[model samples]
Target chain A: MKVRVSVQLKPGILDPQGKAVEQGLHGFGFAVEHVRIGRLIEMDVPGADAAEVKARAQAMCDKLLVNPVMEKASIEVL
Target chain B: MRVAVPVFPGSNCDHDALHACGTVMGWDTIPVWHQEPRLPAGTDLVFIPGGFSYGDYLRCGAIAALAPVMADVKRHADQGGLVLGVCNGFQILCEAQLLPGALLRNASLRFIHADVHLRVERADLPFTSALKAGEVFQVPIAHAEGNFTLEPGDLADLEARGGVAFRYCSPKGEIGEAFVPNGAMNGIAGIVNVRGNVLGMMPHPERVVDPRLGPTGGLGIFRSLAAALARG
Candidate 1:
Protein backbone atom coordinates (compact mmCIF):
# COMPACT_ATOMS: atom_id res chain seq x y z
CA MET A 1 0.00 0.00 0.00
CA LYS A 2 1.06 3.59 -0.55
CA VAL A 3 0.82 5.79 2.52
CA ARG A 4 1.03 9.57 2.67
CA VAL A 5 1.97 11.56 5.73
CA SER A 6 1.22 15.26 5.70
CA VAL A 7 3.20 17.07 8.36
CA GLN A 8 2.64 20.63 9.45
CA LEU A 9 3.83 23.01 12.11
CA LYS A 10 1.08 23.45 14.64
CA PRO A 11 -0.78 26.74 14.81
CA GLY A 12 0.87 29.58 16.79
CA ILE A 13 4.29 28.34 15.72
CA LEU A 14 5.74 30.92 13.36
CA ASP A 15 6.41 29.71 9.81
CA PRO A 16 8.89 32.13 8.30
CA GLN A 17 9.27 30.24 5.06
CA GLY A 18 5.51 30.27 4.59
CA LYS A 19 5.50 33.93 5.41
CA ALA A 20 8.10 34.56 2.76
CA VAL A 21 6.02 32.70 0.21
CA GLU A 22 3.00 34.68 1.26
CA GLN A 23 4.90 37.88 0.73
CA GLY A 24 5.97 36.73 -2.67
CA LEU A 25 2.37 35.97 -3.59
CA HIS A 26 1.29 39.42 -2.39
CA GLY A 27 3.95 40.94 -4.60
CA PHE A 28 2.28 39.23 -7.54
CA GLY A 29 -1.00 41.09 -6.70
CA PHE A 30 -2.57 38.08 -4.98
CA ALA A 31 -4.53 39.08 -1.87
CA VAL A 32 -3.66 36.14 0.34
CA GLU A 33 -4.37 36.63 4.02
CA HIS A 34 -1.92 34.07 5.35
CA VAL A 35 0.08 31.06 4.37
CA ARG A 36 1.46 28.02 6.20
CA ILE A 37 3.63 25.28 4.81
CA GLY A 38 3.28 21.54 5.25
CA ARG A 39 5.48 18.63 4.16
CA LEU A 40 4.08 15.76 2.11
CA ILE A 41 5.83 12.42 2.47
CA GLU A 42 4.62 9.37 0.57
CA MET A 43 5.83 5.86 1.25
CA ASP A 44 4.92 2.30 0.34
CA VAL A 45 3.99 0.06 3.25
CA PRO A 46 3.01 -3.57 3.44
CA GLY A 47 -0.37 -4.15 5.04
CA ALA A 48 -3.45 -6.38 4.83
CA ASP A 49 -5.92 -3.47 4.69
CA ALA A 50 -6.23 0.31 4.74
CA ALA A 51 -6.75 0.32 8.52
CA GLU A 52 -3.58 -1.69 9.08
CA VAL A 53 -1.67 0.57 6.74
CA LYS A 54 -2.88 3.64 8.60
CA ALA A 55 -1.82 2.12 11.90
CA ARG A 56 1.60 1.26 10.56
CA ALA A 57 2.11 4.77 9.15
CA GLN A 58 1.03 6.20 12.49
CA ALA A 59 3.68 4.05 14.13
CA MET A 60 6.27 5.54 11.83
CA CYS A 61 5.09 8.98 12.88
CA ASP A 62 5.39 8.02 16.50
CA LYS A 63 8.93 6.80 16.07
CA LEU A 64 10.57 9.38 13.75
CA LEU A 65 8.25 10.68 11.02
CA VAL A 66 6.96 13.49 13.19
CA ASN A 67 8.48 15.44 16.05
CA PRO A 68 5.97 15.64 18.89
CA VAL A 69 7.50 18.81 20.25
CA MET A 70 7.01 21.04 17.23
CA GLU A 71 5.05 19.33 14.47
CA LYS A 72 1.78 17.43 13.89
CA ALA A 73 0.97 14.95 11.14
CA SER A 74 -1.90 13.26 9.30
CA ILE A 75 -1.72 9.85 7.65
CA GLU A 76 -3.56 8.60 4.57
CA VAL A 77 -3.51 5.21 2.84
CA LEU A 78 -3.64 5.14 -0.92
CA MET B 1 39.65 15.92 33.71
CA ARG B 2 39.12 13.82 30.58
CA VAL B 3 36.87 14.88 27.71
CA ALA B 4 35.29 12.77 24.97
CA VAL B 5 33.98 14.33 21.74
CA PRO B 6 31.67 12.17 19.69
CA VAL B 7 32.35 12.56 15.97
CA PHE B 8 29.49 11.96 13.57
CA PRO B 9 29.88 11.60 9.79
CA GLY B 10 29.24 15.26 9.04
CA SER B 11 30.61 16.66 12.25
CA ASN B 12 32.99 19.41 11.10
CA CYS B 13 33.57 21.01 14.47
CA ASP B 14 34.83 17.87 16.18
CA HIS B 15 38.43 18.78 15.52
CA ASP B 16 37.87 22.36 16.65
CA ALA B 17 36.40 21.13 19.91
CA LEU B 18 39.23 18.64 20.33
CA HIS B 19 41.71 21.42 19.65
CA ALA B 20 40.17 23.71 22.26
CA CYS B 21 40.04 21.01 24.93
CA GLY B 22 43.27 19.26 24.00
CA THR B 23 45.71 21.77 22.56
CA VAL B 24 44.51 24.99 24.14
CA MET B 25 43.08 23.95 27.49
CA GLY B 26 45.77 21.28 27.92
CA TRP B 27 43.14 18.74 28.95
CA ASP B 28 43.17 15.12 27.79
CA THR B 29 40.62 14.97 24.95
CA ILE B 30 39.77 12.16 22.56
CA PRO B 31 37.43 11.94 19.56
CA VAL B 32 35.09 8.98 19.86
CA TRP B 33 33.64 7.64 16.62
CA HIS B 34 29.87 7.49 16.36
CA GLN B 35 30.01 3.70 15.90
CA GLU B 36 31.70 3.11 19.26
CA PRO B 37 29.33 1.47 21.65
CA ARG B 38 31.01 2.98 24.69
CA LEU B 39 32.88 6.06 25.69
CA PRO B 40 36.51 5.75 26.65
CA ALA B 41 37.15 5.02 30.32
CA GLY B 42 37.35 7.95 32.77
CA THR B 43 35.48 10.30 30.46
CA ASP B 44 34.46 13.29 32.52
CA LEU B 45 32.63 15.22 29.85
CA VAL B 46 31.01 14.26 26.56
CA PHE B 47 31.32 17.28 24.27
CA ILE B 48 29.15 17.04 21.17
CA PRO B 49 30.38 19.75 18.81
CA GLY B 50 28.55 21.42 15.94
CA GLY B 51 28.09 20.45 12.27
CA PHE B 52 25.39 19.47 9.77
CA SER B 53 25.21 15.89 10.98
CA TYR B 54 24.03 13.44 8.29
CA GLY B 55 23.81 16.42 5.95
CA ASP B 56 20.95 17.75 8.04
CA TYR B 57 18.69 15.11 6.53
CA LEU B 58 15.02 14.87 7.54
CA ARG B 59 15.86 17.58 10.07
CA CYS B 60 18.87 18.89 11.83
CA GLY B 61 20.32 16.23 14.10
CA ALA B 62 17.33 13.91 13.71
CA ILE B 63 19.38 11.23 11.97
CA ALA B 64 22.57 11.60 13.98
CA ALA B 65 20.56 11.51 17.18
CA LEU B 66 19.83 7.86 16.34
CA ALA B 67 23.44 6.95 15.58
CA PRO B 68 24.81 3.77 17.06
CA VAL B 69 26.70 5.44 19.91
CA MET B 70 23.79 7.53 21.18
CA ALA B 71 22.66 4.80 23.54
CA ASP B 72 25.97 5.14 25.32
CA VAL B 73 25.64 8.92 25.25
CA LYS B 74 22.23 8.64 26.86
CA ARG B 75 23.64 6.25 29.42
CA HIS B 76 26.42 8.68 30.25
CA ALA B 77 23.84 11.39 30.82
CA ASP B 78 21.65 9.04 32.83
CA GLN B 79 24.63 8.34 35.08
CA GLY B 80 24.93 12.10 35.73
CA GLY B 81 28.07 12.69 33.73
CA LEU B 82 28.57 16.19 32.35
CA VAL B 83 27.69 16.76 28.70
CA LEU B 84 27.91 19.85 26.48
CA GLY B 85 26.50 20.28 22.97
CA VAL B 86 27.02 23.18 20.60
CA CYS B 87 24.98 24.29 17.53
CA ASN B 88 23.97 21.15 15.57
CA GLY B 89 25.15 19.21 18.57
CA PHE B 90 22.44 21.00 20.51
CA GLN B 91 19.92 19.92 17.93
CA ILE B 92 21.07 16.30 18.32
CA LEU B 93 20.52 16.41 22.06
CA CYS B 94 17.01 17.75 21.57
CA GLU B 95 16.24 15.16 18.91
CA ALA B 96 17.62 12.43 21.15
CA GLN B 97 15.46 13.73 24.00
CA LEU B 98 18.53 14.22 26.15
CA LEU B 99 17.35 17.80 26.36
CA PRO B 100 13.92 19.37 26.06
CA GLY B 101 12.51 21.57 23.26
CA ALA B 102 12.89 21.57 19.47
CA LEU B 103 14.90 23.92 17.32
CA LEU B 104 12.74 25.20 14.50
CA ARG B 105 13.48 27.30 11.43
CA ASN B 106 14.80 30.78 12.07
CA ALA B 107 11.99 33.31 11.85
CA SER B 108 13.96 35.30 9.29
CA LEU B 109 13.96 32.38 6.85
CA ARG B 110 17.68 32.67 6.35
CA PHE B 111 20.92 31.26 7.62
CA ILE B 112 22.24 33.60 10.34
CA HIS B 113 25.93 33.94 10.95
CA ALA B 114 27.29 36.51 13.34
CA ASP B 115 28.67 37.16 16.79
CA VAL B 116 25.91 37.78 19.29
CA HIS B 117 25.77 38.75 22.92
CA LEU B 118 24.55 36.23 25.46
CA ARG B 119 23.52 36.80 29.06
CA VAL B 120 24.31 34.15 31.60
CA GLU B 121 21.07 33.32 33.32
CA ARG B 122 22.71 31.58 36.29
CA ALA B 123 26.15 30.38 37.26
CA ASP B 124 25.36 27.65 39.77
CA LEU B 125 25.70 24.69 37.39
CA PRO B 126 28.95 23.07 36.31
CA PHE B 127 28.61 24.58 32.85
CA THR B 128 28.46 28.21 33.94
CA SER B 129 30.23 28.17 37.29
CA ALA B 130 33.08 30.34 36.05
CA LEU B 131 30.80 33.26 35.14
CA LYS B 132 28.48 35.39 37.23
CA ALA B 133 24.75 35.59 36.75
CA GLY B 134 23.68 38.34 34.30
CA GLU B 135 27.13 38.57 32.74
CA VAL B 136 27.03 39.33 29.02
CA PHE B 137 29.44 37.65 26.62
CA GLN B 138 29.78 37.53 22.84
CA VAL B 139 29.86 34.30 20.83
CA PRO B 140 29.34 33.43 17.18
CA ILE B 141 26.19 31.60 16.05
CA ALA B 142 25.78 30.14 12.58
CA HIS B 143 22.61 28.28 11.80
CA ALA B 144 19.30 28.39 9.94
CA GLU B 145 17.13 26.58 12.52
CA GLY B 146 18.21 27.86 15.88
CA ASN B 147 14.76 28.90 17.00
CA PHE B 148 14.04 26.85 20.11
CA THR B 149 10.46 25.94 20.96
CA LEU B 150 8.68 24.03 23.72
CA GLU B 151 5.13 23.40 24.87
CA PRO B 152 3.71 26.32 26.85
CA GLY B 153 3.36 24.40 30.10
CA ASP B 154 6.75 22.74 29.78
CA LEU B 155 8.35 26.05 28.90
CA ALA B 156 6.96 27.61 32.04
CA ASP B 157 8.04 24.65 34.14
CA LEU B 158 11.53 24.76 32.71
CA GLU B 159 11.66 28.47 33.38
CA ALA B 160 10.50 28.10 36.96
CA ARG B 161 13.13 25.45 37.55
CA GLY B 162 15.87 27.78 36.21
CA GLY B 163 16.62 25.42 33.36
CA VAL B 164 17.45 28.38 31.10
CA ALA B 165 21.21 28.68 31.14
CA PHE B 166 21.68 31.62 28.75
CA ARG B 167 19.66 34.18 26.78
CA TYR B 168 20.34 36.49 23.87
CA CYS B 169 21.03 39.92 25.23
CA SER B 170 22.64 43.27 24.60
CA PRO B 171 26.22 43.98 25.49
CA LYS B 172 25.01 45.67 28.66
CA GLY B 173 22.89 42.59 29.51
CA GLU B 174 19.43 43.62 28.37
CA ILE B 175 17.38 40.68 27.00
CA GLY B 176 14.63 41.47 24.54
CA GLU B 177 13.44 41.28 20.95
CA ALA B 178 16.25 43.36 19.51
CA PHE B 179 18.96 41.00 20.75
CA VAL B 180 17.40 37.86 19.35
CA PRO B 181 19.36 36.54 16.38
CA ASN B 182 17.38 33.38 15.59
CA GLY B 183 13.94 34.31 16.98
CA ALA B 184 14.21 31.75 19.76
CA MET B 185 11.63 31.75 22.50
CA ASN B 186 12.34 34.28 25.22
CA GLY B 187 15.64 34.95 23.46
CA ILE B 188 17.10 31.70 24.81
CA ALA B 189 20.62 30.88 23.65
CA GLY B 190 21.26 27.84 25.80
CA ILE B 191 19.45 25.50 28.15
CA VAL B 192 20.40 22.87 30.73
CA ASN B 193 18.76 19.54 31.38
CA VAL B 194 16.54 18.91 34.39
CA ARG B 195 19.45 17.03 36.00
CA GLY B 196 21.74 20.07 35.47
CA ASN B 197 24.46 17.78 34.09
CA VAL B 198 23.78 18.41 30.41
CA LEU B 199 23.79 21.66 28.43
CA GLY B 200 22.94 22.45 24.80
CA MET B 201 23.45 25.79 23.12
CA MET B 202 23.50 27.14 19.58
CA PRO B 203 26.53 29.37 19.87
CA HIS B 204 30.03 28.02 19.16
CA PRO B 205 32.08 28.60 22.28
CA GLU B 206 35.14 26.80 20.97
CA ARG B 207 35.61 29.26 18.13
CA VAL B 208 36.50 32.29 20.22
CA VAL B 209 39.12 30.92 22.64
CA ASP B 210 42.09 32.54 20.95
CA PRO B 211 42.41 36.32 21.12
CA ARG B 212 43.97 36.44 17.67
CA LEU B 213 40.87 34.80 16.21
CA GLY B 214 38.17 36.98 17.77
CA PRO B 215 36.27 37.55 21.03
CA THR B 216 37.25 35.65 24.17
CA GLY B 217 33.78 35.31 25.62
CA GLY B 218 33.86 31.55 25.14
CA LEU B 219 36.91 31.17 27.34
CA GLY B 220 34.74 31.03 30.42
CA ILE B 221 32.75 28.04 29.21
CA PHE B 222 35.74 25.70 28.93
CA ARG B 223 37.26 27.18 32.05
CA SER B 224 34.10 26.54 34.01
CA LEU B 225 33.83 22.95 32.80
CA ALA B 226 37.47 22.16 33.50
CA ALA B 227 37.40 23.84 36.90
CA ALA B 228 34.24 22.11 38.01
CA LEU B 229 35.44 18.66 36.90
CA ALA B 230 38.90 19.22 38.37
CA ARG B 231 37.55 20.04 41.83
CA GLY B 232 35.97 16.60 42.06
Candidate 2:
Protein backbone atom coordinates (compact mmCIF):
# COMPACT_ATOMS: atom_id res chain seq x y z
CA MET A 1 0.00 0.00 0.00
CA LYS A 2 1.01 3.59 -0.63
CA VAL A 3 0.38 6.30 1.93
CA ARG A 4 0.73 10.05 1.75
CA VAL A 5 0.95 12.31 4.78
CA SER A 6 0.54 16.07 4.75
CA VAL A 7 1.76 18.07 7.72
CA GLN A 8 0.93 21.72 8.35
CA LEU A 9 1.44 24.23 11.11
CA LYS A 10 -1.68 24.64 13.17
CA PRO A 11 -3.78 27.74 12.52
CA GLY A 12 -2.79 30.81 14.58
CA ILE A 13 0.84 29.62 14.65
CA LEU A 14 3.00 32.07 12.74
CA ASP A 15 4.16 30.69 9.37
CA PRO A 16 7.17 32.72 8.24
CA GLN A 17 7.98 30.53 5.25
CA GLY A 18 4.40 30.79 4.07
CA LYS A 19 4.52 34.54 4.46
CA ALA A 20 7.72 34.74 2.42
CA VAL A 21 6.14 32.68 -0.33
CA GLU A 22 3.10 34.94 -0.37
CA GLN A 23 5.36 37.98 -0.71
CA GLY A 24 7.26 36.39 -3.58
CA LEU A 25 3.99 35.66 -5.37
CA HIS A 26 2.90 39.29 -4.96
CA GLY A 27 6.22 40.50 -6.37
CA PHE A 28 5.70 38.27 -9.40
CA GLY A 29 2.34 40.01 -10.10
CA PHE A 30 0.19 37.14 -8.92
CA ALA A 31 -3.03 37.91 -7.03
CA VAL A 32 -2.38 35.91 -3.93
CA GLU A 33 -4.18 36.54 -0.65
CA HIS A 34 -2.31 34.21 1.73
CA VAL A 35 -0.25 31.05 1.76
CA ARG A 36 0.69 28.47 4.36
CA ILE A 37 3.69 26.27 3.70
CA GLY A 38 3.49 22.59 4.60
CA ARG A 39 5.24 19.26 4.02
CA LEU A 40 4.17 16.17 2.14
CA ILE A 41 5.56 12.71 2.95
CA GLU A 42 5.00 9.60 0.83
CA MET A 43 5.59 6.10 2.13
CA ASP A 44 5.12 2.50 1.11
CA VAL A 45 3.55 0.07 3.54
CA PRO A 46 3.02 -3.64 3.15
CA GLY A 47 -0.62 -4.33 3.92
CA ALA A 48 -3.50 -5.90 2.06
CA ASP A 49 -6.33 -4.17 3.96
CA ALA A 50 -6.93 -0.49 3.23
CA ALA A 51 -8.31 0.20 6.72
CA GLU A 52 -5.31 -1.39 8.41
CA VAL A 53 -2.91 0.61 6.27
CA LYS A 54 -4.70 3.87 7.06
CA ALA A 55 -4.61 3.09 10.77
CA ARG A 56 -0.86 2.41 10.66
CA ALA A 57 -0.22 5.57 8.68
CA GLN A 58 -2.19 7.62 11.17
CA ALA A 59 -0.21 6.06 14.00
CA MET A 60 3.06 6.97 12.29
CA CYS A 61 1.92 10.57 11.92
CA ASP A 62 0.90 10.75 15.57
CA LYS A 63 4.11 9.16 16.82
CA LEU A 64 6.94 10.65 14.76
CA LEU A 65 5.96 12.31 11.45
CA VAL A 66 4.17 15.23 13.13
CA ASN A 67 4.47 17.22 16.31
CA PRO A 68 1.00 17.61 17.76
CA VAL A 69 1.81 20.77 19.68
CA MET A 70 2.63 22.79 16.56
CA GLU A 71 1.35 20.86 13.54
CA LYS A 72 -1.50 18.68 12.30
CA ALA A 73 -1.17 15.78 9.89
CA SER A 74 -3.57 13.97 7.59
CA ILE A 75 -2.91 10.58 6.04
CA GLU A 76 -4.19 9.29 2.69
CA VAL A 77 -4.05 5.67 1.58
CA LEU A 78 -3.58 5.20 -2.12
CA MET B 1 32.44 16.70 38.16
CA ARG B 2 31.97 13.98 35.57
CA VAL B 3 30.51 15.38 32.34
CA ALA B 4 29.14 13.23 29.54
CA VAL B 5 28.90 14.97 26.18
CA PRO B 6 26.93 12.99 23.64
CA VAL B 7 28.03 13.19 20.02
CA PHE B 8 25.43 12.63 17.32
CA PRO B 9 26.36 12.06 13.69
CA GLY B 10 26.18 15.75 12.81
CA SER B 11 27.01 17.29 16.17
CA ASN B 12 29.55 20.02 15.49
CA CYS B 13 29.92 21.54 18.93
CA ASP B 14 30.73 18.37 20.85
CA HIS B 15 34.43 19.21 20.91
CA ASP B 16 33.72 22.75 22.06
CA ALA B 17 31.56 21.39 24.85
CA LEU B 18 34.19 18.83 25.82
CA HIS B 19 36.95 21.42 25.75
CA ALA B 20 34.94 23.79 27.90
CA CYS B 21 34.10 21.13 30.44
CA GLY B 22 37.24 18.97 30.40
CA THR B 23 40.19 21.14 29.37
CA VAL B 24 39.09 24.54 30.65
CA MET B 25 36.96 23.66 33.60
CA GLY B 26 39.12 20.64 34.54
CA TRP B 27 36.20 18.26 34.88
CA ASP B 28 36.29 14.57 33.96
CA THR B 29 34.53 14.70 30.61
CA ILE B 30 33.77 11.80 28.32
CA PRO B 31 32.35 11.77 24.82
CA VAL B 32 29.38 9.45 24.55
CA TRP B 33 28.24 8.28 21.15
CA HIS B 34 24.58 8.65 20.25
CA GLN B 35 24.26 4.89 19.74
CA GLU B 36 25.10 4.14 23.36
CA PRO B 37 22.05 3.16 25.32
CA ARG B 38 23.48 4.32 28.65
CA LEU B 39 25.73 7.01 29.97
CA PRO B 40 28.80 6.39 32.10
CA ALA B 41 27.95 4.98 35.49
CA GLY B 42 28.81 8.14 37.38
CA THR B 43 27.78 10.77 34.86
CA ASP B 44 26.90 14.01 36.61
CA LEU B 45 26.18 16.25 33.66
CA VAL B 46 25.02 15.36 30.16
CA PHE B 47 25.76 18.10 27.63
CA ILE B 48 24.02 18.05 24.26
CA PRO B 49 25.83 20.38 21.92
CA GLY B 50 24.46 22.28 18.92
CA GLY B 51 24.47 21.14 15.30
CA PHE B 52 22.21 20.00 12.46
CA SER B 53 21.63 16.59 14.03
CA TYR B 54 20.48 13.99 11.49
CA GLY B 55 21.07 16.79 8.98
CA ASP B 56 17.82 18.39 10.16
CA TYR B 57 16.00 16.07 7.76
CA LEU B 58 12.53 15.60 9.22
CA ARG B 59 12.82 18.62 11.47
CA CYS B 60 15.50 20.21 13.60
CA GLY B 61 16.61 17.62 16.16
CA ALA B 62 13.59 15.45 15.39
CA ILE B 63 15.59 12.38 14.40
CA ALA B 64 18.27 12.89 17.04
CA ALA B 65 15.64 12.90 19.74
CA LEU B 66 14.84 9.30 18.91
CA ALA B 67 18.43 8.09 19.07
CA PRO B 68 19.29 5.37 21.57
CA VAL B 69 21.33 7.71 23.73
CA MET B 70 18.29 9.87 24.37
CA ALA B 71 16.60 7.08 26.29
CA ASP B 72 19.48 7.21 28.74
CA VAL B 73 19.38 10.98 28.66
CA LYS B 74 15.74 10.84 29.71
CA ARG B 75 16.50 8.39 32.45
CA HIS B 76 19.31 10.60 33.70
CA ALA B 77 17.09 13.71 33.61
CA ASP B 78 14.32 11.89 35.47
CA GLN B 79 16.79 11.05 38.22
CA GLY B 80 17.55 14.78 38.69
CA GLY B 81 20.83 14.67 36.81
CA LEU B 82 22.02 17.85 35.14
CA VAL B 83 21.45 18.14 31.37
CA LEU B 84 22.30 21.15 29.24
CA GLY B 85 21.05 21.35 25.66
CA VAL B 86 22.41 24.12 23.49
CA CYS B 87 20.83 25.33 20.20
CA ASN B 88 19.94 22.21 18.21
CA GLY B 89 20.26 20.27 21.44
CA PHE B 90 17.63 22.58 22.89
CA GLN B 91 15.34 21.65 20.04
CA ILE B 92 16.01 17.96 20.73
CA LEU B 93 15.20 18.36 24.41
CA CYS B 94 11.83 19.84 23.53
CA GLU B 95 11.24 17.09 20.99
CA ALA B 96 12.02 14.50 23.66
CA GLN B 97 9.49 16.24 25.93
CA LEU B 98 12.20 16.81 28.54
CA LEU B 99 11.50 20.50 28.06
CA PRO B 100 8.30 22.31 27.18
CA GLY B 101 7.36 24.08 23.93
CA ALA B 102 8.91 23.92 20.46
CA LEU B 103 11.45 26.04 18.61
CA LEU B 104 9.85 27.33 15.42
CA ARG B 105 11.46 28.93 12.41
CA ASN B 106 12.65 32.48 12.96
CA ALA B 107 9.94 35.03 12.29
CA SER B 108 12.27 36.75 9.81
CA LEU B 109 12.42 33.56 7.78
CA ARG B 110 16.21 33.64 7.88
CA PHE B 111 19.01 32.07 9.85
CA ILE B 112 20.17 34.38 12.64
CA HIS B 113 23.86 34.19 13.52
CA ALA B 114 24.98 36.87 15.92
CA ASP B 115 25.88 37.73 19.48
CA VAL B 116 22.81 38.89 21.37
CA HIS B 117 22.36 40.32 24.84
CA LEU B 118 20.55 38.24 27.41
CA ARG B 119 19.33 38.91 30.93
CA VAL B 120 19.79 36.39 33.68
CA GLU B 121 16.13 35.95 34.55
CA ARG B 122 16.62 33.53 37.47
CA ALA B 123 20.09 33.40 38.92
CA ASP B 124 19.15 30.95 41.64
CA LEU B 125 18.60 28.05 39.27
CA PRO B 126 21.31 25.42 38.93
CA PHE B 127 22.18 26.67 35.44
CA THR B 128 22.49 30.37 36.36
CA SER B 129 23.72 30.26 39.92
CA ALA B 130 27.01 31.96 39.08
CA LEU B 131 25.27 35.11 37.86
CA LYS B 132 22.95 37.61 39.48
CA ALA B 133 19.41 38.20 38.35
CA GLY B 134 19.03 41.00 35.78
CA GLU B 135 22.71 40.80 34.85
CA VAL B 136 23.34 41.22 31.17
CA PHE B 137 25.60 38.97 29.08
CA GLN B 138 26.41 38.59 25.40
CA VAL B 139 26.08 35.13 23.84
CA PRO B 140 26.14 33.90 20.28
CA ILE B 141 22.95 32.50 18.74
CA ALA B 142 23.12 30.58 15.47
CA HIS B 143 19.95 28.91 14.35
CA ALA B 144 17.06 29.04 11.89
CA GLU B 145 14.37 27.61 14.20
CA GLY B 146 15.21 29.35 17.45
CA ASN B 147 11.90 31.08 18.03
CA PHE B 148 10.29 29.44 21.06
CA THR B 149 6.52 28.99 20.96
CA LEU B 150 4.11 27.66 23.59
CA GLU B 151 0.44 27.82 24.46
CA PRO B 152 -0.70 30.86 26.45
CA GLY B 153 -1.58 28.85 29.53
CA ASP B 154 1.63 26.87 29.35
CA LEU B 155 3.60 30.09 29.10
CA ALA B 156 1.89 31.35 32.19
CA ASP B 157 2.67 28.16 34.01
CA LEU B 158 6.34 28.22 32.99
CA GLU B 159 6.76 31.78 34.19
CA ALA B 160 4.89 31.12 37.43
CA ARG B 161 7.24 28.22 38.15
CA GLY B 162 10.36 30.32 37.49
CA GLY B 163 11.45 28.05 34.64
CA VAL B 164 12.63 30.92 32.45
CA ALA B 165 16.42 31.02 32.81
CA PHE B 166 17.40 33.73 30.36
CA ARG B 167 15.59 36.37 28.31
CA TYR B 168 16.83 38.39 25.38
CA CYS B 169 17.55 41.86 26.58
CA SER B 170 19.35 45.09 25.74
CA PRO B 171 23.00 45.64 26.62
CA LYS B 172 21.73 47.49 29.66
CA GLY B 173 19.42 44.60 30.56
CA GLU B 174 16.14 46.11 29.44
CA ILE B 175 13.81 43.59 27.79
CA GLY B 176 11.53 44.85 25.05
CA GLU B 177 10.43 44.10 21.51
CA ALA B 178 13.56 45.78 20.16
CA PHE B 179 15.83 43.35 21.99
CA VAL B 180 14.20 40.13 20.86
CA PRO B 181 16.45 38.52 18.21
CA ASN B 182 14.32 35.60 17.01
CA GLY B 183 10.80 36.42 18.17
CA ALA B 184 10.79 34.07 21.13
CA MET B 185 7.71 34.54 23.27
CA ASN B 186 8.34 36.62 26.40
CA GLY B 187 11.88 37.11 25.14
CA ILE B 188 12.83 33.69 26.49
CA ALA B 189 16.29 32.60 25.38
CA GLY B 190 16.71 29.77 27.85
CA ILE B 191 14.61 27.77 30.26
CA VAL B 192 15.09 25.14 32.96
CA ASN B 193 12.98 22.12 33.68
CA VAL B 194 10.66 22.18 36.67
CA ARG B 195 13.37 20.64 38.85
CA GLY B 196 15.91 23.19 37.63
CA ASN B 197 18.39 20.46 36.71
CA VAL B 198 17.90 20.38 32.95
CA LEU B 199 18.44 23.54 30.88
CA GLY B 200 17.84 24.21 27.19
CA MET B 201 18.91 27.39 25.46
CA MET B 202 19.38 28.52 21.90
CA PRO B 203 22.50 30.54 22.67
CA HIS B 204 25.87 28.77 22.40
CA PRO B 205 27.62 29.16 25.72
CA GLU B 206 30.41 26.73 24.93
CA ARG B 207 31.36 28.87 21.94
CA VAL B 208 32.13 31.83 24.20
CA VAL B 209 33.86 30.21 27.17
CA ASP B 210 37.41 31.16 26.10
CA PRO B 211 38.34 34.83 26.00
CA ARG B 212 40.83 34.10 23.22
CA LEU B 213 37.94 33.18 20.94
CA GLY B 214 35.54 35.92 22.04
CA PRO B 215 33.91 37.48 25.04
CA THR B 216 34.01 35.29 28.18
CA GLY B 217 30.50 36.25 29.26
CA GLY B 218 29.37 32.63 28.82
CA LEU B 219 31.92 31.20 31.22
CA GLY B 220 29.60 31.95 34.09
CA ILE B 221 27.14 29.34 32.83
CA PHE B 222 29.74 26.57 32.86
CA ARG B 223 31.03 27.76 36.19
CA SER B 224 27.53 27.57 37.56
CA LEU B 225 27.27 23.96 36.43
CA ALA B 226 30.57 23.13 38.08
CA ALA B 227 29.53 24.83 41.29
CA ALA B 228 26.26 22.91 41.33
CA LEU B 229 28.04 19.60 40.84
CA ALA B 230 30.65 20.41 43.46
CA ARG B 231 28.02 21.02 46.10
CA GLY B 232 26.42 17.68 45.34
Candidate 1 lDDT over B109-170, as tens digits, reads: 88999999999997998989999998989999999999999989989988999999999998
Query: Alpha-carbon error at A31 in model 1, in Å?
Result: 2.3
Once fitted onto the true fold, the runs of candidate 2 whose alpha carbons sit more than 4 angstroms away are none
Scoring the B chain of model 2 against the true B chain gives a TM-score of 0.98
The lDDT of each candidate is: 0.92, 0.92
Model 1: per-residue lDDT, tens digit, A2-33? 99999998887888989999999999999996
State the DockQ of every prediction: 0.85, 0.78
Which digits, one per residue and each the tens of the lDDT, describe model 2 over residues B1-232?
8999999999999999998888889999999999999999999999999998999988888899999999999999999999999999999999999999999999898899999999998999778899999999998999999999998889999999999999999999998988998989999999999988889999998888887776888999988988898899
lDDT of 1: 0.92
Error of 2 at B125 (Å): 1.3
Best by DockQ: 1
Count steric clashes of candidate 1. 0
Q: A-chain TM-score per prediction?
A: 0.94, 0.95
Query: How well does candidate 2 score on lDDT at residue B231?
Result: 95
